[model samples]
Target: MESIQPLIDKAHELIQRADQLQSKEPSVRSVPKLSKRIKAELNFLHTLQSGDVELKENQLQSTNLTHLEAVLSAAESLPGVSDIFSAKHATDEKGNQKTLVIDVIANHGAIWVKVTARRGHALYRVWQGEGDYGDKDIVEQALEYNNFASSNPVKFIVPKVHVMFLKGLPSEVKGELESVGIATHGHVLSNTDDHRIDVPCFDWSVLKELKVIHAGDPRRNRVNLDVSTMIAMTSNLTHNGCWFDYPECLLINDQAIEERHHPQLTALYDILKGKQLFACSTAITIYKDIVGNVAGPMEQARAKMLLTKVRIVDDCVSKRTQELGWSNKIKERPKIIFGTGDALEMVTVSANGSFIRSASKHNITYAVDLHQSRAFTERKEAQAVTIKKDDAFKRINLEQILRDLLNPS
Candidate 1:
């Protein structure tokens, strides 16, 4: 037993060093070495505990393996020591021998997170990286292999997959993602001092509760808008009494030119200036036409200023038609332009683009006439009474109008 004293002393020394290291500030550079040392020590203790007289060449020499293993295992059971686990991967079943590539997969209460990282500027898509695979491809494979969305744990609460970029995104790209309800972060792991393997699992239930709170607001999704509403707002701009009709609005550059300040139009501009709104490519083309021709240089500048903020949605014409149940009516009917109200519902314009109408069958849920909607009305009332000194229109009870618009009584 005297022969074991040196090995016992060394083991105690290692434990003391580890305890001291744990108390000091951690350095990312030193973490891997420390983990490896602790793992090796744990292995040595386990081997001695098994009473295997023939020690493997890789294991440290120890005579009191049983006692050492017991003590080391007990230490591991300490509250903070076992805070992390190595990320896991699963092999493909089709004999591909390729493991699903995921940086980390972990359960935090009811939410299971599958994290992927893109380290640079290359667009993330399938088979676009060095190995003919990219972050998206691996995530897609993981989803299929794990069947995550419909899996038992997810049935309780849907899983949120977060894609972390180790680099920053361009403003345009970030804005696009923001429109779709995805919030991205740059170097989330490194920024927070989270070692990939040591990230702590958290309770995701709070996120679910927050989502429930915002469930009633449609602004959570991107808002789509129609051309008629644009005309309604811009025609009121007092450029001329004849700013042209629907299709004419699209070709307004060829129309007569003018410069004037319409109060309602200015108020409408104030309402929409910073708001994130989507329009069909056609509607955008019309706005560009006006900018190029109808508007004076100053108005063109204003149009150019605002156009960048409006995202031109893809397949806008077809999507609008389909939503209106006119999939087959595409060529037969007048082109259905799209618009969104403050509530994020579809704004139905008359066939002739005369005005917004509530009785239109194409209405999604509630309808808004640009002339009479609560937001427009309240702004108009404010301008007329406060700015224009027009008492003919009393101030509408805007708070009630907003409540009615949101709750739809």
Candidate 2:
């Protein structure tokens, strides 16, 4: 190609000369010169060969790491794909340098594929150029990979093996691999669009055969507070006077539809429903003191309704012991029941009931005046307060405090 550069430049020069001559007025002298130059450039071009620009076997090409990573990321998301990792060999056994091997551990019956980035893409054209197809060598190497993987201490039953390719193979080649109880699949990573419908390239059939088991988040079933905590929170709300006194003044206005309590209520509901926290008599005392001034029948009825949702723990000593035992068995510690004033004493009796305490070994109790914290602020609504804690308490909002018995950090 380098040798042909001089000739190519000369041809371009001659074409420009011819173009200049043609652009001039149509004189006999100019027409003859243009024809002569055009003919010379044409003859030179004819002497050039296609082999000059063709890539030779010795030519080296670099893999695009960006494209490779994109392909790997997509592969990682494939159904049954897990534990995608890679290793780099500075020098191979033959003394070749810079070898990278990617291992894709997939499960159904537990299989693994070890491949180079270059050969990894079968269904999707991962790079800019042409794709690779199933080869006999690749098929053989895959067996060795599966064998190596199965030999590990981790137990897996890989009865069948499969070779992957970027492009589909001839029926004869597929039959050859199948003869050994091994399977082969051409590219299934690329998506297809037909009319208005779209189809993905993932092989669903393979996953079905594996019988992969899937599950949702485990903690979804766990609410923020337990039954006892809900009862304590309800008892607290009943005692909190302002919460009942300023229902419309605090959150609801002339333009409001429903009570603004749900935001706070729902936050508490989620925490209580999830059983994230434990509650005690201190929390109950705070609630009772907060709402103790309320004597209105409507207000009392509303308080009773909210209280109904709370599961009050039995006052019985055995039931309390049973509840405490249950809370201790879980992996996570129940949230603390926080309060101020007489809660300073870890143990104390109140006239209303036996001394209530957040005493479960698995749970905690924090006595703090959340209202005195910098995170607590007064809302625009004259009677209401806005409590917003940053970072540490970002998720623990005002309603959550009421429900979960957690003080602002």
Candidate 3:
């Protein structure tokens, strides 16, 4: 393309020359420049063959990372088609449930997935996009058609998204998140004392107005508490700007509608009390587990809760055993896990009730606890037990918990 530079300059010169001669009829005076302009136009046309003037373009909107692969698998697995948009059912749940809502826009709207399928079953199915398919269109289809029993390979269509949350955000990983843009005070942490909030904090008042009420001597090395405050306030999910919580296995669903019998939106809201959407439904549970580091997959399956088996292979703690009792009516069966941190550290938890409930902080009370229980088997012995003295007891206990959860001897 650069090779055409001289030609382009000559074209510009000829265009000006032609303009000068326009008032007069074509004559010997204008012949040379007119010929040059025509030749320049011809050259410009030829350059198109090799591609010319690569226009400055922003990145094309890409698929949402979490759902793109799954949707592609569904599309290719079907008889025909390569791209699709659809929602897949979550494997963790039983019965007719919808796991994700995808909107694929390609090839004249190829296929629309109303429900996500798992283990030959389906759930939480809905249509997402320009059409108004009503509420239970897909759900009824799942019940009436029984796509599960069909021999035909069910095709799915899932769209992709380009936006994401701000937490766990990598520095080099670029994004256009507004809240992230607002909290451009401090980029790193220097002793978290500057920001006093929980591990996954969500407070943003300081940065909302982009003001600083507190004062400190100008210190380049000092932590920006205001920025820290905004980061803390960032929600698990955001609409436009303000962030909100995405409850367990759910997105930031709205429950404001009124319905007498089946408040479908409410039901969706109930399922996702404290969670948000990032990817498709196929791997939501897995994504949740890895990020929260709550517990292993097998643990979640066996215990019917997020469970960890922290081992006590190495020497551990004193001759003390404790039991924690926690209950929440909001749950049909509460989350459970076993981890390294004792009831004290609150870091390691069996069933990881903390992460599940805390994924998006809830006002409802949770009673999980650790209470010591004394026994009559106490002995007045000469030798002291070494398990109680080891500092690695936490690590050991975490291993034992996993073993117990996995092997369960």
Candidate 4:
């Protein structure tokens, strides 16, 4: 196998050049473009290094990065593979542009090899002349590549994501590819294990900052839990053997204050239904102030229907709480709970920095602003130290927050 270490070294040098160009003339628009290209090439170089291929400079076009990664991964796993060629479209005698039928060609002794990256489950339709692989059948395309090579070609189909080969590709499709003399490489995962590992879906590092923010002056610093963020946090808690104690009252945005048919109510109901995260609660308090303020008959009816639905759900969840093993946790008293009250009251109470008790005897913790806004590096009521919905979903640490909330000493 040929090594691309020298090319990887060259790519690093190009990155330095691009950086120098940007530093010398930051105002030049083309310098940023050059830097972007160099960055992409550097990523490609790192990908190829993972594949362990001896690559040539001719194989390094930015456009062919995906196809080349697939081919290199296949080459690294397959035996007796040597002298790989990156094929391009060639004109027929008619002078019309011809389609590039094969992405890569490899010589395994006297046999001609063609490699393709089967991106998704659409290959079956593509091969049968029914989809985007064009009007020509994939078998016919393989024959065309063979005709161009002037020899019969051995075909190899590798999945774009190596693990996808195991479950994503249907058995029928694998059989069809093999029936036509095209080898499907599903076992390439072992060779590319380092590259096939799953990446974290959420960034959890933000939790440390969130903990500090939430701990600040419990009254003034409030963390607002939006529907989706609440869902994620509750789901994480459930996974970690904890559950959210049903809130005293479900408080939504100021929109709910005006509109009886606000979508946030429906969203919260759906989250509760889907996850069954809130349990072991007697009943939810629908604030008379909020519900009684509905402007019209239709709005009143919607509010009534929502309350009815939530009550039914709560009753069902309360019954199953013991069976679900949340009874003990429920008895521990919910350290962190979510609800909304008058915005002015929340600000006033926080400003006073006083812990107040409700009729239910739950102590008031600091308030969190779940409304959409940028995070404040400096604590300011104007910036509000709010947790944006985007940041809550994108960044990590809800699990730790749950732990601290449940076991606060």
Top candidate when judged by lDDT against the true structure = 1
The stretch of ten residues in a row with the least summed lDDT in candidate 4 is: 372-381
Clashes of 4: 14
Candidate 1's TM-score: 0.27
Runs in model 1 lying further than 4 Å from the true structure: 1-222, 228-262, 266-274, 317-320, 323-336, 339-369, 372-409
**Prediction 1 global C-alpha lDDT:** 0.36
Better of 1 and 2 by lDDT: 1
Which sequence of candidate numbers ranks them by lDDT, best first?
1, 2, 4, 3
Regions of candidate 3 where Cα sits further than 4 Å from its true position: 1-96, 101-384, 387-409
Q: 288-324 in candidate 2: lDDT tens per residue? A: 4444453234433434554443333212222223344
Residue 61 CA error for candidate 2 (Å)? 4.4
Could you tell which candidate, 1 or 4, scores higher by lDDT?
1
What is the C-alpha lDDT profile of model 3 across 50-137, one tens digit per residue? 5765522221111122122233322322222222333333332354443543322122222233222111111112222223344343
| Candidate 2 vs 4: which has more TM-score | 2
Clashes of each: 8, 25, 57, 14
Best by TM-score: 1
lDDT at position 16, candidate 1: 61
Estimated TM-score for each candidate: 0.27, 0.25, 0.14, 0.24
Instruction: Report residue 398 deviation for candidate 4 (angstroms).
Output: 78
Which ten residues in a row are the worst by lDDT in model 1?
372-381
What tens-digit string does per-residue lDDT give for candidate 4 at 87-113? 434457877656453333332322334
Question: Once model 1 is optimally superposed onto the true structure by TM-score, how far is the C-alpha of residue 278 displaced, in angstroms?
Answer: 1.5
